[model samples]
Target: MTLNRSIGILALICLPAAGIWFWQNPTVRQAPQLSFKTIKGERIDLADLKGKLVLVTFWATDCPGCIEEIPHLVELHRQYSNAGLTIIAVAMYYDPPNRVMAMAKAKQLPYAVALDPSGSLAQGFGNVQLTPTTFLIDRTGRIVLQNTGAFELQDIRQRLNQL
Candidate 1:
């Protein structure tokens, strides 16, 4: 094949790969304007947390994955809370407050735990319907990461460190 033709073919292959990488990875986006009232009666507004790195996780008490992730979240909170990291675990509207509170107590979660009784929190976050959906917002209020399933703790830690 001619050298020009070979170069053209390589460019075509690489362009799609780059596009896919961009599509699969996190992109800069503004976080939704919302306020959360924690089960502890602490009102946390996103605007108030503008200069902090926040992790807003949507979870349900009954979800096995969510249940399994509590410890990790707790540890993350312990490790980074003092370093400007704020973690909020939000219980789905379907989950009764009693159950949510019980799980929080049982898990000994140290972060703010909010109850989405009206589902407005979920709706504001792109109509999230999956348990363990997490949004990592930077200090500037831009969502740097959005994971809909189980997320790697190390990856989160690295991102947190980078921020």
Candidate 2:
């Protein structure tokens, strides 16, 4: 095939792939009721967390960005739990329970870390491509803000204050 034809075919292949990826990954419109087992092995239902400011962050154990943001999340939970905030870290990819426990212990995370071994919860929340996606749900259970990447402490604080 000619160089121009080869380039055209490559573009054709890449364009559809990009489109599919973009279509499959969009900001979550409605929050789904996710039921998962916490690292402590207790079943928790997302609907049970209503009437509180909840941060549902989807992350994976191997994600560097997710690892880096744990401390910030811990701080947010610490500063605001007394104010009726609930932060739940939903692990999108499966890892050994020990690893999850160790990371939580090392960071001294005060919030609950749940396991989404099948990643269905992550997909339901429109966080297909990224780890560390955070959704802020108000007391009434409406998603007020959805962040696809790592967030700053100030941003989290401001969002919490608004709730």
Top lDDT model:
1
The models' CA-based lDDT, in order, is 0.92, 0.80
Return the TM-score for each candidate structure.
0.88, 0.76
| Candidate 2, position 10, lDDT | 96
Model 2 pairs in collision: none
Quote the RMSD, in angstroms, for model 2: 10.2
Which 10-residue span in candidate 2 carries the lowest summed lDDT? 22-31
lDDT tens readout by residue for model 1, 1-163: 6999999999999999999877876556899999998999999999999999999999998898888788889999999999999999999999999999988888788999999999999999899999999999999999889998888899999999999
In angstroms, the error of model 1 at 149 is 1.2
Candidate 2 lDDT for residue 16: 97
